[model samples]
Target: MTETALSFELPANLAVEKFIAKLSKKTVIELALQQYSLKTFYDSFDWRLYNANLICEFNQSKNGSSLSLISSLNGKVITSTELDDVPAFASEFKDNVMANKLAMLLEVRALLPLTTVDLQIYKINILNREQKTVARLMIEQYDQLKTRLSIQAIKGYDKAYIRLSALLQDEFSLKTAEKGLLIRALKRQGRKPNDYSSKLNLKLTPEMTAAEAVRVIYKTLLKTIKLNEQGTIEDIDSEFLHDFRVAVRKTRSALSQIKAIFPDEHNAYYKEYFAWLGTITGLTRDMDVYLLSFDDYKASLPESMREDLNPLHEFLLFKQAHAQKELANHLKSKKYLTTLHDWELYLKRFIEKEDLQKNTHISIKELADSRIWKVYQQVLNDGAAINEDSPAELLHDLRKTCKKLRYLMEFFQSLYPPEKIKTLIKALKGFQEVLGNFQDYEVQEISLKQFSEEMMQQGTPSNTFLAMGVLVQGLEERRGKARHDFTGRFNDFKVPLNQKVFKFLFAHKSKGE
Candidate 1:
């Protein structure tokens, strides 16, 4: 492959004022290149100096004790995170950015883990017009590229953070597919390849791993039961259900994440474990998201104008109950337990192997990032469609894929800066929430409308039918408003998205070469 000269300089004395100056002047890239980082993609931070047409990073140092911000002109302030804490910072940025009310200081001087300095910078134009500035860019000193980025050298504990932190933090890096890492461990243990381990890398984790996938099935079943309530259970809003179902999907992802690297035949439960859960949850989860947005659709309209709303609501509610029931029975079945036991046995076996010692130094986060992007590209290539027949349903499915991507990104977050990770996560979450809200209202509207009509047909008291009808109409109004809100958000993100996330994931960079 061919290469080009792009500069990325780091702060030898790194200070806030100088850092601010570096950002304001757009010199961070040169600084980044000085250390030779090979980061191919960047965030809004990379654009701080000047939105370069293209960004390439090279110099990569191992993980550090404190946070490292690379102004390396890759175009974003990529924070090197050793700690997995970013949502809190991301939330702060979101709040601050949305407020748009500049704090007396927009610079990072006040931020933690870094100090202030002489913040000044100059612009460099070497693109477009015979080599000219196409736009009056922000006059800043952020270097697009930066110092080398590397891992495995940090003075950490005995094992990979995965197992080491387990005893300390009571948290285990969530796993989806365990086979890949296991393969790596086996190699370290000098295991020879056999029919048992061949072609394991090509395997796909079923819709849900048998062991962990049940979390989703059970959650979906609970949602179904809550919705069924026969008027007895108090179900939370669809948003709550939406969250639960999504979490369940992640558990499925965890199963897949941990297994993608291992050989399948040796793993008895590999093929059968996730298939059943995936089928049931796939259908129920789709409906759950749609039902949540159903009410939002009705709510969008004015109280006086929802003639079509009544029937739409009725049809959806009736249909959803069926989906919910399927989920409930799948969870209640003894088959689920049988699958879980098998899966557990496999994990226990894999973990106890002599090969397990090799994985002690392994980091699953790295493995996850590479595979996650491959998965995203695969879906993007095969193509997914969203339309009226089941727009909400299709969208929820899309979000599940998005969740896997999100989780993978989160795991290897130290590979990038907290800010960069947060920004991407925030944008993706925004997209999900917009569609998510719309789907929520749509579902509620569907259920209540059907309930009222049924009561009316049965010659029930006017109070029961009228009360439910009023609720349905109220829901339609909410739906109309939600529709507007969802559309507005969805449209606003159309252009910003291509630059923001699509490129972020697809960009290929050698491991901090």
Candidate 2:
């Protein structure tokens, strides 16, 4: 059924019963109350649904459970499906319109429970002189104190809706509700949507000491680590572990690249710890990447050969689960806990010290300019050195250099002209994309071969082995293309416009500056 509804927030002090009693004086009012428990809001880790102005909720009562996908923009139920049970993953949804839509929106990501809320729904019918329903009102009281009022006009009753809206506004002081009840409740609990992201948002100043700047960066990374810890342990999604690994890598990069910012011994010690962290997570993340690409891998083969690939998929799944368990155990270990605690304490202690090391006293702008310029030139030289005849390892090494340069650019982006830095970063990213794909394809080829051996040992069928060979060939073709594209990508990055911007930002700085 198609209907238009307007949502508003009722003042906290207003009671639904009292409001209905007051409305009874103007017209006949009918009320129905619904108590919903185990009401959950679902979204991707990134809040894709909320960002798209969509609300997806699962409600369970004594009778059964229902899933509702509503469009917040129009307050309409886009689709509703009654399920025997709520599936943990979107792919597990039965064949239905709602499930299809959700699968498209959340392809590989699990639908994480953002928040749970208990709703007290009061459905009201406003009638006219003939006792015919003219309009409908839904007042949803969340737990207590918070209420959302929705007024929907019955078809052919626009005048009634206008009259009722005016009466509610004039008498009760209704205001347009900009946020959903789930969001409001989350706010009341001091949490908000999109509260975490993998990107760096730390604010660094030119006058801040190197120790303080390093502290700020590490603090942000530490928080990211902590934020993803629960999700990683629960195996909610691969991204949690992926993001955790990235944070650790960034922390390591900061320590090694931004030399002398912290004490030598501390930097060395934490670098080792972070290296351990990265190693422990490596197998799991690698398996996650392979498994996540399973669909594409299957499609790479002919239809006749696709069914044979199921065994490979099972093998990958088995390996992923095993690796994930190990990673979780490592995360929960005493050694891991002690490392994080010591690192945090180190940051706090060093940042508060009034005395500055020699390098820490320098202005961040000068330091950034010097280091970025050095890395930028290094990338150019390295990229220029590579040719069609160059070994694949050369390209791999150059990719690593590009990563360091990219991280430097991101860390000190605020110190330069905004547009200039943005343009340079964009160009660098395009170059890195080619290098990254090239490396990934290479890694995938090696991994598939390794898995084939393991599968054989485990008595995998010969058909599965043949399917894996086809997959390996497919990866090689992609890798070759990426290798071929490197020249064009490098040239694009080294174009005069980007070169000028990079030079203007980082080239003029000196050691003594």
Candidate 3:
């Protein structure tokens, strides 16, 4: 049997008795009431499930509690499980198809309770001449205020469903619901989906001055940093510290790369403070990365020896707790608080009466073109000079240069054609990935060696050190492989077509243009 359902918003003025009285004139109807139930909605902090058009809800009724995954588009149940409680992570759920799908989407992220609503349902039956049910209608009131009406079609009763729909629309003047209950409830609470992201999405124009554009970028970055600070202090997840560090790094890069937009002394003062901020937050974040990657480290060893790494995991966790405490203390210190306050106050001072830098009054387009072209050439020069015989420092330097270029392009992407800038960024990404992998593997091996020493000093097990040795060997091999792939990736990045596109999009323009 085919199934179709339609939902409409009930106007506030419509009384339940009056509506039932109006409906009885058109068809034979019977109304039944059910006790109110509570439904708690869940989603990731970033709304990963809701953004994908899926909803996870746990319903609590007199009978029992059940967890369900439903489609937001048609309001149909996709999968469900009868459970007494919801788990923090998807892997804790019973092993089944639904659990597997949830695990794939929510890797390393915890499920958070979004909101709860009281739902009271009224089930109405549309009867035929013989008193058999032909179609089903429901009036649902949420939190004792918001109401919705839904019509469900029974088998071989499509005509009844259509007739009921027309009567509700033509006579009652009820309009279709434009948004789902989750969205409407969130709106009422002054919250929104997809509100927080680490990406840079600035709306810049060519005519704005360089100083004005820089201020705009700085303000956005500052806001992102402040928003993530409490989460980082609480150690909610690794992503909080990861995003916080990214904002700090981006701020430092912008200050150094965007020359002549601010006074030299002012730039130096903030640069020093931000560098200190980066240092204090470094150890705990490093430990977070190591813990997050522990499974991969174990997988690199022989299956028989993988369990031997458990002791090393314990050692790392012990150190992480210490590092976390240190980091939290620093974040709560007066120095950290004062530095951010001073930075914001400095940014707010727009006194045009003060001294101006050389490039402060220039068009933003002019500054973006000149700075981006300069860095793009440096990337080409650095990549071309590296070879099999070159030192690792050269590759590391190239990686930092590539990062600066990527940030510059992102900051001023609005000045260039969207497609062209995106193409260049995409091509550059491949090159950056290889370099990043090479460096990551190298750093992991070195840190593991240091960790092994610390473990020995702390009287860790011998088998754990043996397991780490094997892991280091595997990482070295992978790093070598990534280093070998670097040349081909660089070659693809500097191909004639890519070079032509880069030049056309960002080449410096003459004054008259």
Candidate 4:
């Protein structure tokens, strides 16, 4: 049976024992005490549960560990499970509601411990003349500084609960609790829900100069770098390095794509460093992708063959660990520190510099229009030149070009009509996804072949080589499908309506009427 619970904040002056003594005079009060150690709350990096009005808590005691998924609104436990150990990924859980919900909510992200607090719990039963419990009270004290009270009515005892609540309110001045203990604990430590996001949320106006806009983008990237540093250092999850690499890519893309907004020499200098950053982190991130998709890759093969793929998993783990060590060392090195310091100083200097360059002073709209038009025309020219028999390198080059155009569109999207730009970007993204898959499959196949050769030199089993061959074949088939779908995807993107929207928004016009 389900019960309704009402929560309150205990007054600062009232002790739990004293409150119970006052209540015992009127009715029988039974007290039960429980203590929990190593109580931790878990959430996605973006706080998906807190935003959904859910609280997920992990409690560890002498017996074992247990996880509870509770509704923060009504303090009802949606589910609870006794966990042998905490899972590294949501997908690690076998088919269960908690796993299903978590997988859907935290796709490609791991649950990280947000905060830890010890809980001192008191359960009070209010009994009547017949020694029947009608009302329940739970008082939770977190870390000795925070206290919360919850009053619950037993099934079929609404009127009895009302009288008990009235008496408790009269004895103690109770206030409605607006936040759960987890949230209050987080606030006590100076953190808030949904405090971090990787997306760029800058607000730019048309009047802002090209240089100013570029600085805004750089600052956002800088913040992303600072935010991911802890995760990278601790190796909490693969996403930390993934996000770090992406931020670097965006920074490099901004410098390269938005040319002349910064000095050409300065841009070249930083582009080299960012490119180096990407190169060093590539192996780790690639291994991360392959490991994350390991199960899917195995499922594609016959069940009997899946067991033989274990060696490949071991190799990936070893290489990933080695690559991560290299990355961590580089991140902790003087060069990395100096590069960031120099980059920040350069941005500040450029933004405040009085003698701006010619292109820096140009209105962002004109600049965006000119660049977008040039890139779009280039894409048309290059895409039309490709046929079914073209070399793989041709498609690779075209993919890079598409990425540049897409980034340009995203960076300057706000300067155009919202609906028009949204439609155009949606089309562009669909086309880019096709190209991206094609390129990725090709790269993976090539990497697998290279690894196979290395494993053979290390005296790996022939069965392992056979499994690698199977994976390579699967990737080739996927690549072929992507290639086959490209023409249709491009046609959808390059339709006349989208072309017209592009022209209306960014096409260059002559001086004459």
Model 2 Cα lDDT, one tens digit per residue, 200-239:
8878988886667767888999999998998998899888
How many Å off is the CA of 178 in candidate 3? 1.7
lDDT ranking of the models: 3, 2, 4, 1
In angstroms, the error of model 1 at 384 is 11
Per-residue CA lDDT of candidate 4, range 70-102, in tens?
A: 888887888788896778677798649878887
**CA lDDT, candidate 2, residue 86:** 68
- Total backbone clashes of candidate 4, pairs 3 or more residues apart or in separate chains: 0
- CA lDDT of every candidate: 0.41, 0.85, 0.86, 0.82
Of 2 and 4, the candidate ranking higher by lDDT: 2
The residue ranges of model 1 lying beyond 4 angstroms of the native Cα positions read: 1-247, 254-259, 263-334, 351-366, 374-397, 411-415, 453-459, 473-487, 491-506, 510-513
- Best of the two (1, 2) by lDDT: 2
Candidate 3 residue lDDT tens string, 1-513 = 435479898898887667888999989998855556788888876677887789998888887888888888878777889888888788788948767878888776667788788887778889999998888888878864468888888888889999999999999999987777777777877887777776888878999998888888888899889988987888866777888899999999999999887789989989988898899989888888899899998888999999999988898899889998998899899999998998897888843544488888998888888788888999999999999989999999999999999999999998889999999999998899999999999998999999999889988879898999999999999999999999999999999999998888778472432
lDDT of 1 by residue, 446-465 (tens): 75665557656756555445
Task: Assess the local accuracy of residue 32 in candidate 2 as a C-alpha lDDT between 0 and 100.
Answer: 53
TM-score of each: 0.37, 0.93, 0.92, 0.90
Q: Rank the candidates by TM-score, best first.
A: 2, 3, 4, 1
Better of 1 and 2 by TM-score: 2
Supply candidate 1's per-residue lDDT for 276: 53
After superposition on all C-alphas, the RMSD of every candidate to the true structure, in Å, is: 21.4, 2.3, 2.6, 2.9
Give the CA lDDT, 0 to 100, for residue 39 in model 3: 84
- Those runs of model 2 whose alpha carbons end farther than 4 Å from true positions after fitting are 1-5, 9-14, 32-38, 62-64, 129-131, 173-179, 510-513
State each candidate's clash count.
131, 0, 0, 0
Top-TM-score candidate index: 2
